[model samples]
Target: MSAPTATARRSRTRWFALGAVAVAGAAFVAISVSGIGDNLVYYWGPKELRAAGDKAVGATIRLGGQVAPGSIKPGDGVSNLEFDVTDGTALVHVVATGVPPQLFRDRIGVVVEGTMTRGGTFEGHRLLVSHDNKYRAPADKNVDIKTLMRSTAGLEER
Candidate 1:
């Protein structure tokens, strides 16, 4: 081929490669934007969810609340147990038929990870025990307040 024609062909190939790269990049961006909503997580309170009306149907969610006072009914002779948890303003009835930790009790702080059923009941997948402010350290029962505060920063003043 002539010198000028050979150089022109090489330049054309470079531009073609650049165009291919740009198209691939745009396709990747479009796919990422389209899938954004699918990865979103929704946090719900018992009251806010109940108020959602028909929108709450078949949606996966996480609910936070305290175990209702005197509502925990441990199994009579089986692992199955029933309880009610409240978010102070809203209450949700939970049915957990598994072995419960000793910390599980009425009026204690608790979190249940579950999904809401069509019948309005929560089926727990895992149970969490909440702690109170009065936690005592078993290692050092005799540590004075002043020393303990000095050891752990930000806690001494409180």
Candidate 2:
């Protein structure tokens, strides 16, 4: 092939510069994301939360565990809820507002986020139920209409 024209060379050079910038930007993003884990926490179990003790007060935390059996209670205000999260080793009492998801029930896996009060209670503002990604249709005979409707009475929001 014949040598590239001057215009062609300039166009190629511009493309190379753009590629280099894109690569640099990608590398920078990768490095920044890699270091983020050290500064942020995803979740902590009840035992770990309790262990934090005095340090936990007023700290934004995501506490994860199963809902303790017999601990769900309605608070004084309407829509206020109280419950306990347990890892079978320790438990943290949680006071939250807003509706819980349909899957929320006794012994169900959950993640609650908020700050710990000075009284050793977690004041949760958000609640999440841990669920598998896969979806399956329930058998006609296995599903209970009454129970299902009760469980899904209020959809979780906020």
Candidate 3:
């Protein structure tokens, strides 16, 4: 064939470049979506957990709810804890082996990450305490703000 025209070569080059860019963009999106899917942790309350039934067995999930009143118990090990998490509608038994955070207590919100067992108990590997966003005034009746500010002024001067 005769030598290709400059315009024809430029046209082919532009199409090839566009195709490469499109392929790169598609690959980037595919990778990003897959990564997000693998790392996403769906939070489930007691009712949702119960509704999940057998489908949730052995799947890692985040259980979010309040620790049931009077359900906290000492587990087999020193750091192990057993409690029931409830959302007022349903409850799930949780067995966690770790150092519980200082805020962890019954009647308080918590999110536990672990897998649900076939027996319907959550085998928690991590524990997170959830606190309300509302702020409350301190109840120290004897301490005056002026006196406290005066005491801290010396430290600030230094």
Winning model by TM-score = 3
Estimate the overall C-alpha local distance difference test score of candidate 2: 0.77
lDDT of 1 at 99: 74
Q: Model 1 residue 31 lDDT?
A: 71
Q: How many steric overlaps does candidate 3 have?
A: 0
Per-model lDDT: 0.66, 0.77, 0.77
Model 1 lDDT per residue over 1-158, tens place:
99999999999999999999999998888777878534553345567657865676566566556667679887766555888876567888887756777877665556567777788887776776654454458687785653332211111122
Question: In model 2, where do residues sit more than 4 Å from their true spots?
Answer: 1-39, 133-158
Stretches of model 3 off by over 4 angstroms after superposition: 1-41, 140-158
In candidate 2, list every pair of residues with a backbone clash. none
Give the alpha carbon lDDT tens digit for every residue of 18-74 in model 3. Answer: 999999999999878768644454578788889989988887888888788789998
The TM-score between candidate 2 and the true structure equals: 0.60
| 1 or 3, greater by lDDT | 3
TM-score of each: 0.52, 0.60, 0.61
TM-score (C-alpha) between model 3 and the true structure = 0.61
Worst lDDT run of 10 residues, candidate 2, spans 149-158
